[model samples]
Target: MKNVFIFTVIGLLFLSCKPEEKRTDYIINGDASGVYNGVRAYLKEKDRTGRERIVDTAVVVNEKFTFTGKVDIPKPSVISINSVNGNLNFMLENSVIDISIDKANISQSQVSGSASQTDFDAYNQGYAKLKKESVDLQNELRNIHRQLSSGSSEQLQSKKDSLTDLFTAIRQKEQDYPLNFTRTNTDSYYSLVIIEREINKKNANIKDYQEAFNNLNSELQSSAAGLYIKANLTTLMVAFEAKSRVDIGKIAPNFEAPTPEGKTVSLNDIKGKVTIIDFWAAWCGPCRRENPNVVNIYNKYHSQGLEIIGVSLDGTRSQKDPKQAWVNAIEQDKLSWTQVSNLSYFLDPVAQLYNIQAIPAVFILDAEGKIAAKNLRGNALEAKVKELLAL
Candidate 1:
């Protein structure tokens, strides 16, 4: 009985002493020849606010540095070393990684240990080919455009045809590559990563992004990349809707904001007339110069059922108050129109609704509030107004 009890107690002690299973932790150790001895390394992951969250930091020790952390799953993080030698942006996954960074040949640096990194290597190799071809085609198109002014009529037509083909091929390939890859690799989490990266391109179409997103695996849809896509996808949809509204033959999206006199004015207030939706900011020198042209057009066309609705992008700043500036500019420029603003600058809700990319933008709306034209400046603005009024 004594031996039996002793054995039982020993077994219990052994059981209690056993180490728990190790969590998913990563150790990134690497050497860079050109880095300063005490240079800091920042490990970062992007957050929803379009900013990076510093996961950790390590200082170079004895020409080597190490970082240790636990990752619930694979994450796309960057090891950024900003030093006197230059900046090194090394992309890595959250796994035990051995980095071999060549300062002189940084692009050719080798990173091993993570399966996802291996996949990244392969993806970039293929992507490089397509990007190279796209760049070459773009260069050729630019050179062709430079010759447009002096080209013979037939030559110009031929150049135009070539330019169209090259441009179309480039866009189609960029769009199709992600769509085809995501559709073929539905279960691949990295597929969502690639789509997330590509969908942020300025030329990305909403339909393509949606199709690719839907094709992703359900598990991937719950991943970090998927969440990033979901957030940006919402922004893209808003921009897409706004873009469509400003296109010719589409009705304008109505908005209401406060005028300089604290009176609220809405786009619908100026309906039943040919109205110009002018997007301008008080700080824009060109916008101030262009104000006279707009004034002239309004004066000449105001009698013929022409109306103007100016949307000022001006907002207050710490150094200067934009409301006073906006009011001053209006009075000085003699802009006699129904103007409104929320004073939020680019973040102005109305500007975002119309997808206003730059100042001095205008959408000429017809009598029924459908966009008849856009970006009609100087004589073009006057001519379009005249033509619309005649109709």
Candidate 2:
């Protein structure tokens, strides 16, 4: 009876001590016939913002390689030789994934074994076909132009017009295909993957992003990709509509930033006067060169209700301190106008709000704080200031 009791205690301890292997363990096996033996392989993953993490490494042995690791959830992974020679990418789901490469062609290589990876490959194959057609149309158009330029131009114009239209249609389809997929596949985690490529593009589209974001399932919407979009989509929308934001007829977007003395100052702080919101950087050569011209205008117009707010994009990198750089620039340039900076350089809140892409950017506001003119430099800037103050 005592031995039975001891055995029961031992059974409980054995169960408790056993490690979890199924939930965490993932096995990757690959055969690359053309890739030389003993080549190093890197397994990299990204954490939401698309920053790479080299989780593990392996070496090819006898034309084969394997990686065994554990992960809590599926992650986006790039299996590459060294760091930059990317082999292929797949959703590193918790499964025994197999890769087969033939004759140095990574593109034609077959990746199998994980259900999520199967879905990824199928979707990617269809997407690749669509992209190829887009490229083919472009190449055909370019070829036609070359033939026309070198030979007789008869019947070429009509062909060119039709080809141009076809190219435009194909381009639009290529851009919209992934967006449509995201909208339809609410359950798949890769749906977020498709939408993220669109969202992170230069001057991202607001309407499409909003629609795709709404279509995401609750599970995906709370994931890292969704959280990143939630944090940044508004900022992108504002930046994308910068032309409208900077147009002369719109009310200037109000921005608050710290002054040279560490006190917060905003557009509203000096609202009753004509203001020139000058975007400049201490490190900007053009801004430095143009400072004398700006200084002259400020001296001439300051008494006449012309107020200049110098927005400095400086002190963002770890190598330099923003406060000291701003003060030094102001003193060196003999800038008498009020200056402010968040010290985040280009990503400064005000800079992002105004969609200030270029340095030496200027926005002149009228007495009521409405945008008067934009990006007017030197004589144009002085002329506008004089004209507005005269009003």
lDDT of 2 by residue, 1-391 (tens): 9999999999999999999676557899988676777788778897667878888888888878888988655566877774224467788877888888644545566778776676577678878988898898889899898988888575887888898998899888777777777777777767766666677776556667777787777877787667776667777766557756766778999989999888899888875468989999888889999999999998987887888889998966753676787889999999998889988889888888888888989989998889988888889888998888784
User: For candidate 2, what is the TM-score?
Assistant: 0.58
RMSD of 2: 10.1
Provide the lowest-lDDT 10-residue window in model 1.
84-93
TM-score of each: 0.56, 0.58
- The residue pairs that clash in candidate 1, if any, are none
lDDT winner among the candidates? 2
Model 1 lDDT per residue over 2-64, tens place: 999999999999999999764467888777766778887777776534477788888987667
TM-score computed on alpha carbons, candidate 1 = 0.56
Full-model lDDT for every candidate? 0.79, 0.80
